[model samples]
Target chain A: MCQLLGMNANTPTDVMFSFTGLATRADEHKDGFGIGFFEDRGVRLFVDHHSARQSPVAQLVKTYPIRSDNVIAHIRKATQGRVALENTHPFQRELWGRYWVFAHNGNLVDFHPRLHAAFRPVGDTDSERAFCWLMQELAKAHAGVPAIAELTRTLAELMPTLHRHGTFNMLLSNGQALWAHASTHLHWVVRQHPFGAVALRDEDLSVDFAHHTTPKDRVAVIATEPLTQHEAWTAFTCGELKVFVDGQPLG
Target chain B: MCQLLGMNANTPTDVMFSFTGLATRADEHKDGFGIGFFEDRGVRLFVDHHSARQSPVAQLVKTYPIRSDNVIAHIRKATQGRVALENTHPFQRELWGRYWVFAHNGNLVDFHPRLHAAFRPVGDTDSERAFCWLMQELAKAHAGVPAIAELTRTLAELMPTLHRHGTFNMLLSNGQALWAHASTHLHWVVRQHPFGAVALRDEDLSVDFAHHTTPKDRVAVIATEPLTQHEAWTAFTCGELKVFVDGQPLG
Candidate 1:
């Protein structure tokens, strides 16, 4: 299976540590990798059909300290689409005068929803098709960008239809909040005050949050699996959909 | 005035030389800089609110050697928008299953058009407003993506309306072809067989095309002013709209 990683924070934060953990897992899933960083209303999306383990783009992501409030990343194993540049995720589109980014971990068998609205998939992946359908339905659900709670409620209503097809674990962000849904394996952790050093499960690298972050900083990270061994990670239920805002989960 | 640069080629070609020439001019137009490169249907967009002469992102563009068939780049003087990341161009949006990139060099005065369609300006800039209006009208002009020739003809009809507002020099690309329209200053040059060495107009750097490009390779480059010192550059007439496909301008 492909792997997924996401972050939501009250302030802009760099994801070099977590991304390094994710990139180490690229050994198994070497089709492609992509990461999107949301800086206010703008997004810097770096996608390569090359493996994150070796791609220079991935190297830039690891070394550059691009602070963003929301981030979504994926390492692809090519379950549904060809290993082409156009098929690389995370996919991005504009809606309601803002950019929306999406990345999927699991596979869908034959899911193809009606894409009647303005959004369309440039790629042939089912993930891109699902993202387009979500944008279309979101556009129809509101005249303009509605409240985050309303969007979460609408998305809650739409998730089951997509979930019925197959595994639908995914992460989405519109720079305001991050929404993550899981039908299979997914885990998360929240780091706050009194931060301690943590070690990566797949690599020898570790970082002490106490040195790098402020006491008021709060960060929530979600991944297909626990990225670090020492952190207290929480696993999502089989059919859970959660919305994270400002580093905290909003029920 | 801001500066514009564009490239359309018969094959995927690295843009380091032309972009370096453009970056040297960023010494004055240091409000921001952006570049978009199309590889097949996928695009790699690098934008920074910092000057291209010093921004780390711009440094990556210069060193990475990412190749593409179509490209659009801008060095902004911030004539209409704040010097923020969100306001940086070339602006991108998806329409009819294809990503469209746009960058404008000149200004428009009191040129707000009705934006009743799906495309909207995320940034508060006259250039973005104009681009959104163009996308909205183009969506109305055709139900789906028109042929390149048809789209160029439609743009030819649409340019006069925007040109009358003020200076509307711009470059647009949809990965298939590049369209350049000028209300004031714009120039283009085509490089083909028997390529020779050329020097940058703004910098002392020079590169011999014969060592880098194949005999069959053809490249069309568009800029606000000529980028090379020795090349024969053709200046666009006022209100002229030109379409380039496979490195050649279509009559």
Candidate 2:
């Protein structure tokens, strides 16, 4: 199985350290590696089909420093398709006058759903097909950007239908709020005031957030596994969905 | 806010298509993107600090194809860390002779847990700290490989302790099974025989997995959100955990 990681915050922040460990699993050390993040106005992405452990680019990524408010990252292990650039994770698109990002962790049985005019797939994997369909549905539901509550409610209703076919765990964002759903397994955690020091699982490193940010800053993290051995990481039920904004769950 | 995606299968599968859509939101579109997967022997990874929508590498990922049985993917909006390589998600490590992959989507407040071991952080993100703590705990719990049930129970006991500090939702895998937990929000779904069509949420695409897999194949997906418009995606309850192996949840 593959791995996933994500972050949401009340203030703009960086995810360099967490990403450093994640990149190692990509083909660089074992498989390829990829990352996506939002900046001042747009999104940035980097991917290498080569193993992250072996790739110079992956190494560079570990040393390079960048920051943002929302972020997503992935590492690859070929299963359904050959290792190639076209099959990387953390896909992107334009929707509702803003950029939308999506990533998935599951296999579909025979997911050949028809598409409307709003969304389309650029790859051959089942994950991409599902992304396109979601965009299509969102477009059909509203002509323009909808309220967070409305959008989330719609997604809650649509999620189960997709889960019926196969595994359909995914992450989605529009630079405003993050939406997460699990058909089988997923986990999350949020960090806020009273900043503290933390260490990494993959490397012998740690940092104190209190030294970096104000007490007002709030942050949320979601992943396939708990990053820390000491901290509590909540697990998602078999069928649950939630939306997050500014490091807090939407009402 | 950031996004996450994942897939688990009874047989080998690929997540290229799903990743394609997810990568788009990293920088120009979202912020950053990363993906992780488990191969036959180890974990593989791919990540980029660019947006999946505009990064040349992101385009290549969509065109290049890679497959895997277990996969995880993410897209970023940079709520926690900088836009550099070190901050990407889907971090990895080696445990028990197998590659263990982890990714996070929430933040911790004042989470300065002191490490008893040498685990450290490579970046300035809180996610890395959590990853390290988890590894430390695992190392302390089992000197060598332990039974799945034992490991699961140990994790269950550890979870509440970690949750006390803040929200903790995450995913973890050691190329054997995928474990997920939810604190605020996460979702999942299982797919088995009698596969069907699935659509995408970010793009226009679809696939028929029934045409591609054997009847014995079973798969499970976990994510921060649902990726399809026409399928059923289950949501995880607050503070729940589940494990998926060979496309089915372990009891």
Candidate 3:
């Protein structure tokens, strides 16, 4: 299976520590890797068909401290589409004057929806097609940019159709809120206030979050599995959809 | 004034040498810098609100050698919009299932069009507005991606409306061909057989094209001004629009 990593923070925070953990897992998922960083209304997306284990782009992401409020990343194993740069996640598109970033883990058997609207997939991936359909449906469901709660509700209503096809584990962000949907394996954890030292499960590297973060800093990380061994990671129930804002899951 | 650099090659080629020259000019045009590389149907866009001279992303771009068939780069001076990532060029949008990249050099005065279509400007800049308007009109003009000649003619018809507003020197590409329109200053050069050593105008960098290029390899480089010291760069006349495919301009 491919690997997915997402971060949502109350303040602009760097994901260097978490990304390093994810990159170590790129040995098996060597098809491609992509990461998107949201700086307010703007987004910076870096993708490579090369593996995160060796891609220079991934090296930059590991070293550069690009502080962002929301981030989505994926290391692909190429379940369906060919291993091309266009087919790498997370895919990006502009809708309602906001750039949306999406990354998917699980595959769909035959999830081809009619894309008659403005949103179209440049890549030949079931993931991108599903994303375009979601964008098209979202555009049709609302005339303008709707409120976050309304958008979340609309997404909740729209998730079942996609989940019915197959494993629909996905992470989506519009620089406002991050919405995560899982049909299979997915986990999340939040770190706040009394941040402690954390060690990566895949690598010997560890980070003292207490030294890097303030007492008020809050961060939520979602991944295919728990990246850190000691963290209180919570697994998502099958067919559950959750929205995260300000580093916490919304009720 | 901002600086613009575009390259369309018969084969996938790297622009590190030419981009180094452009980065040298970023001393004056230091609001931000962005470069978009078209690798087949995929695009790698790197934008930084910091100057290219100091940005780690730009440094990685300089050293990584990402080869592309079509490239559009801009180093901004921020005449209209604030120094923000959303306002950085070249702006990108998807139409007809192809990714189109655009970067503008000159500014416009009072050029606002009704953006009722799917295309919308995320940044508050006349250039982006003009680009959005162009995409809107192009979508309305053709049901799908048109032939290069037909698209060029439509652009020729569309140039005057934008040029009348103010200077409108711009470059656009959709991974197939590169289209450049000029109202003030724009130049292009084609380098092919018998490739010789060339020196950058601003930087001390020099490269011998004969070592890296084959006899049949052809490349066309477009910029606001000539990037090299010894090259036959042709200047575009007022209201002139040219389309380049496979490293040579089409009449």
Candidate 4:
């Protein structure tokens, strides 16, 4: 199985600590690694085909300092395609003058859907296929970018149909909001105001969030697993979907 | 927030489908990605610090064909440290002539523990500190490798103590079995003889495990959230720990 981690916040925050713990599991997921972040103007993306465990670049990621407001990460265990660069995840596309980022965590069997738009998959991953399909659906739903509520409703309608094929856990963002859905497994946690200390479950490290975050800062973390062992991470019910904006859940 | 996905099976089953979808989220987590797998002979590892969203290599992971019995994957969103390769996860250390893989999802506050063994952290991340600490603990517990049960008990004791510091949810494996502990948030699902179709909540995709898995195969998926929208995923209670082998909980 692969893994995913996402963050939506009211303030620009760094995920260096949380990411350090998650990346340690890449030894067996040699397929690849990728991460995307939204900064002031656009999205910053980094990816490598080498195993995070073995890749020097991956080490740089842990030691290098990078900050952002919204972020998503994925580690691969390669079930559908080959271990190549073109097949990486967090597929991105330009839509409505905003860069949209997407990542998936399941397989689609016989998921060859007709894409009605110009958006094409650079990789052969089923994840990319689904991403393209989402773009197509969004395009067909409204002539232009619709309101968040409308977009959510459209996603709710389109998600079940996609589930008919296989596992479809995914994370999506347009730099303004983050949309997450769980077909099988996904989890999330929100941190705000009175921040506290957090420790890594995989590693014996800890951090005092209070030291870095502010009282007005609100942050939401979504992932295949809780990054910390002590926090009250919430689990999304099967078939549940949610959208986050400025670190708060959007209805 | 970062993500982790793990699979334990009764037999040597593949986790390709689940991983394919999970890898898609790497864009927001472009910090890095990593995966670990345990086979009959030894453990296999792969990882990269690239964003799965755009990394050609991550795309290959989704499309690349690989199978394993036990698997763990991670996508990173840098929080505690820099985005470097050595900091990438699913950190591996040799113990008792077997390779052990550890992946963490949380951050530890002021987790600077002293080490008295050869095990040392190559990265500045606290996750590595925990890994080294675990190794050191194991080395101190018994001169030679003890039984799995004994090791598990030691871990249980060690885990709760760590949780006192902060969130410590994590997955640890030594090739023979998987030990999972959840101090705050975590979930698990078991798929067996009666396989069914699963849809991803994050993406418009699905897969019928019945088609790919045999009746004898029993798979236990552990994650921060349920990856499929249709499957029943059980949530791990606060301070709950379990040992999984052959896709079932151990006594």
Candidate 5:
């Protein structure tokens, strides 16, 4: 399966995304990869037609402590789009004066929709098409940027339409909140105050989060699979849509 | 004046834009900087709120030879918006299923225009506001992507309106053609067959075009000033809009 990772924090947090050196996981999703960080209203999107483990772009991400309140990363296996820079994810589009980042895991069979709006896919990908459709629908549903809860409600209604086509596990963010809808495999873990040393995988690099986090700081990390073995990661059921704000999932 | 750099070529060409090294020039435009490269239909934009001389992103541009057919680079001195990442130049938007990149060199005063469409500025910069207005107008002018001549005509009408506010020297491209509009200083130079070893300032690195270009390859470079001392750069007069296609300027 393609890999997806998302993080939303109360404070702008520096993520050691590649600190554990996920070389084994990279091989499974090696068509290309991308990562996006929302630093306030500005978005820094880094994408490459190379494996995250091998891309120079990824090297910079690993070395640089890009602080952001929201982050989304994806590794693609290229089920639909061709293996090129244009097809790489997480794809980005701007709507309602805010940048949206999205990444998907599963493939859609024949999920084409009428794109009669401002948003359109630059690349030929089912995922990009799906994203454009979602943005178009959202723009239709609201005149101005809506609150997170209202957006979640709108998305919950629209997601089922796409889910019927194929496996639709995905993650989305608009810098305000992180939205994840899973048709199959997706997991999340929330880290709160009194954080301890957190490590991903077996014998991976560990961070003494307690030394860095404030009592009020909370973080929610969503991925296709549990990144850290010790953390109590919660798995999403079929056809689940959840929104994360200030590092905590909201109804 | 804030510096703007753009390149359009028959084939993908490399640009050496370490404007930070232009300290005499940098002093005037040290607020922030950005650069965008169009690779096929895909666009890669790197922006930072740091001075070009110090930004890690600019350093990457200097170190890496990213080849593209169309490129736009800008160094901002922040006239309207606060010195923040969102306010960085070389702003991007999607229109007619193609990604459009824009960068402006001059400031506009009281340039408020009704942005009654999907395009909106994520930043508070007047430059971004101008860009959003352009996108909204362009979306309105054409239901689909218009021809270069048609777009040039639409822009000619729009340029005068914005020029009424203040300076409006700008560059825009949609991977098909490069357009330059000027209310003041904007220069362009075309390099064709019998390529020469082009050098900028004394300390600047030179490129042996003979080695990298074919006899058919033609490139047009537009900048706030003539980048190379030897080339005969043509300056645009007030309220003039010109489009460059296949590395040649079109009437």
Candidate 6:
């Protein structure tokens, strides 16, 4: 299985600490890794077939304080495709004059959907195919970019078709909001005012949120597993879909 | 105006020397910069609103030596759009399961085409708009990825439409081949067997190609101006479009 991490914040924030925690876990998921950051409508995507622990691109991601409002990252274990750059995670495409980024964590058995639209996967991975299918469906559902709530509803209606094939834990963003669907394993945490110190579950390093954040800043982070210890990480139930905006999940 | 640099090589080649020369010229074009590298069907794109001279991303690009077969890079002066990430050049989109990268050197005056297809510009730049329109037209012209010759013909037929608007010097690549079009300022050179030492035109740096490349290696480089001092760079006439494959331009 692969691991996924997503962040949506009310303000631009860096993911150096969270990404370091993820890279430490890259020992098992060593096929490849990718991350996408949305700075408004512009996106910067870094993908490498090398393991995140060794890739210079990943090293830059860890050290560079790239402040973004919406970010999606994935570390791949390669269940469905060969270990290649095209099969790396955090696939991105442009739609409706906006860029959409997606990353998946699980495999689907025989989950081939018709891709009759302009959206097509450049990679052979099942994950890329799934992302292209979703983009095609989303493009068909709306003439242009609709409201985020409408998009969430459309995605909610479309999730079951893919979830039935197998595990479907995934994260998607369009620079506006992040949509997380949990078929098996997913957890999310929101950091707001009165931030406290937290330690990585796997790494010995610790960081105090109070030192890096302002009182008005809010950040929500979603991952396949809780990245840090002693935090209010909420596990998602099976077959649940959630949309996060402004660092909080919508009801 | 921006500066454009493109490379198409028979084998994977690092652009550190060429890119360093380009970055040295980024002093005047200080709005932003971007570079896209094609690694087979996969692509690695790095863009920043920050100037290439100062951006950490550019620093990594210079030192990391990410080898690629086809490369498109731009240093922007921001003629039409604001100095933001979205407005940076070398925009990318996918068509027919192949990723296409584009970067423009000159401005297009009042050029807006009807974008009625899957490809759309996330950035509000005339360069991006022209690229999106070209993608849409290419998608419409073919059912899938056609042969290189067929694509070149289609593009040749479509270039005048964009050229009539204004300056349309551009470089485009879809991993299979690179297409460079010039309206005013563009130059190209092919390097093959018995390569010799070359010095940068703007920088004090020099590199010996004989030390790095095999005799079988062939490389075609395109730039707004000649980057090297002694290379036999052929200037492109206005409205000339050339397609390069396997490191050589087609007749």
TM-scores of the candidates in the order shown: 0.98, 0.51, 0.99, 0.51, 0.95, 0.99
Candidate 4 lDDT tens digits, A122-208: 556788888878887887777667888888999999998778889989999877789999988799999997899989888889999
Tens-digit lDDT string for candidate 5 (A1-251): 78888899999987765323343488667798888889998988888887877876777778778889999888888898788777888888889889899998899889989999999999999999999999999999999899999999999999999999999999999999999999999999999988998776844577788898788999998888888868899999999999999999996
Where model 4 places Cα greater than 4 Å from the true spot, the runs are B1-251
Error of 5 at B96 (Å): 1.2
TM-score of the candidate numbered 3? 0.99
Predicted candidate 1 versus true structure: per-residue lDDT over A73-179, tens digit per residue: 99999988788888999998888889899998788888978788899988789999999999999999999989999999999999998899899999999999999
When 3 and 5 are scored with TM-score, the better candidate is 3
lDDT of 1: 0.92
Per-residue lDDT of B106-172 in model 1, one digit per residue for the tens? Answer: 8899998888889888889999999999999899899898999999989989999999999999999
Residues B1-251, model 5: lDDT tens digits: 78888899989887864243332366557798888889888888888877877777777777677788898888888778888878888888889889999999788998888888999889898899999999999889999998889998998888888898999999999989999999888988899999888776635566678897789999998888787767789998888898998899986
lDDT of 2 by residue, B1-251 (tens): 56677788878887765665455334443566777766654344666766667654455456654556778776766656677656777776444434567777777777777765534455566776787778778878887668777888877877776677677778887767787888876778787788887777777877787887789988888878776667678998887878888898899
Error of 3 at A146 (Å): 0.9
Runs of candidate 5 with Cα error greater than 4 angstroms are: A18-24, B17-24, B202-204
**Clash-forming residue pairs, model 1:** none
Candidate 1's chain A scores what TM-score?
A: 0.99
Provide DockQ values for all models, in the order shown: 0.72, 0.01, 0.79, 0.01, 0.68, 0.87
Candidate closer to the true structure by DockQ (higher is better), 1 or 5: 1
Which should have the higher lDDT, number 4 or number 6?
6
Interface quality of candidate 3 as DockQ: 0.79
Error of 2 at B63 (Å): 3.2
C-alpha displacement of B133 in model 3, angstroms?
Answer: 0.9
Question: In model 1, how large is the Cα lDDT of residue A180?
Answer: 96
Cα error of candidate 3 at position B162, Å: 1.2
